[model samples]
Target: MAEINVTPFVDVMLVLLIIFMVTAPLLASGVPVDLPDSRANPIDQQPDQVTISIDPTGTIFIGNERVETGGLPDALAAIDRGQAGNEPVIVLRGDRTLQYARVMAVMGELNRAGFSSISLVTNSSQSAP
Candidate 1:
């Protein structure tokens, strides 16, 4: 009767840890995108970077925010100006089901916004040696 039972405490802690482990990865993935596989080596992720995602429908999203098609240029320009002098890398992710033209158009807009440090995100099919 004097002994303390710690079984309940350990069970609760284990459950919480498992929940966090399952959800942590989902947070970094952001929007759902079926990225195309590439054999090229993966690049190092930048500390200061912007994520632009284009879904299978060709809809564009800046980070998690959705922007109008006509407003993409201005949106990108605003981000560019907001950064002052620091040139942040732009990571573009387009669904593999999308047309090449759509991706090119987004790239063109990025270029127009004076962002030269742009990178394309792709799922690597093979590990780089």
Candidate 2:
């Protein structure tokens, strides 16, 4: 009877697990935005959701895809059609450096498009609440 050693395999697996753990949080940093910090608790997010990002320059994006100039309503309509029966939360991520009116305009567009489930994404406050 021959028995193979499993120690090396376990060590390799452990190293891989540690590597993944370190990088897992970094993976969600999509479409860089300097989000404003808030003291409020974070919302319970679902897996199925649509992300609307507004950068510092006021450029709009739907899940990393850019929306054409002055075509937000049309883009939102397309999203609604594509999702069909699935009603996903529309998460709005506006850069901290962005103008207040710019964020409001995007929210208005979402409202006009009939997306009721909306969330405003913000970074956690550094200081204690």
Candidate 3:
């Protein structure tokens, strides 16, 4: 009686496992910042959605593009005008050290620029191990 060899199957599976292992870390999120913890749930399901990040240094970023405080309104307006809808959905990621007033001011600017679908980006406190 002759037995069929399964070495090829084992080799393919091992290769796939190695590939996944190598790419898994790359799939993780960007650099870790001191994200403001919250009890509120995040609404975004798509990873490619628009995001505006405010660093602790008061630097403003629109979809990863660094913009001056004066340019924020125009930057947001550009994003809004380029979108399919007038009211673009934006995720605001502010540092924990960011002042409440500054954050509110950003939100106000977004509202005045015609963005009604703004969502605050926060990681659930309960999610941390």
Candidate 4:
């Protein structure tokens, strides 16, 4: 009787699992934003939610595509139309180093675009105390 070698297969599987675990978070958001720390609980992310990322330099991105400040409403409108009847939720990820006014400007644009369900993304607070 011949026995299958399970040890080598298990080693390969463990290595692949470790690689995925390390890369999963990095792949989560294409646009990297240094989010501010918050004590608030994290919200469940819906698959169809629209993400708007603002980098440290104040450049805005809708998904992975860059959009001008003036063009934000139009971009969001396009996304809204593609969602059929389901209401679109906008997730804003602004860098921590950005000024409050810059962040507010983006929010104001979303508000003007008639997107009510907006959530700000922040990193969970890590305190030693």
Q: State, as a TM-score between 0 and 1, how close model 1 is to the true structure.
A: 0.82
Off by over 4 Å in 4: 81-85, 127-129
Give the alpha carbon lDDT tens digit for every residue of 1-129 in model 1: 599999999999999999999999789767899999888777988777899999999999999988897999889977844456778999999999999999999999999889988899988887554
Q: Candidate 2, which segments miss by more than 4 Å at Cα?
A: 81-86, 126-129
Model 3 spans > 4 angstroms off: 1-32, 80-86, 127-129
lDDT of 2 by residue, 29-104 (tens): 5678899989878898778888899988889999878898998988998874346666888989999999898899
Cα deviation of 91, candidate 3, in Å: 0.2
User: How do the residues 22-61 of candidate 4 rate in per-residue lDDT, one tens digit apiece?
Assistant: 9998998999899998887889999878999999999999
Please provide TM-scores, in order, for all candidate models, with all chains considered together.
Answer: 0.82, 0.85, 0.69, 0.90
Winning candidate number (lDDT)? 1
Name every residue pair that clashes in candidate 1.
none
Backbone Cα, N, C clashes tallied per candidate: 0, 0, 0, 0
Model 2 quality (TM-score): 0.85
Candidate closer to the true structure by lDDT (higher is better), 2 or 4: 4
Give the lowest summed-lDDT range of ten residues in model 3.
25-34
- The candidate maximizing TM-score is 4
Model 1: lDDT equals 0.89
* lDDT-based ranking: 1, 4, 2, 3
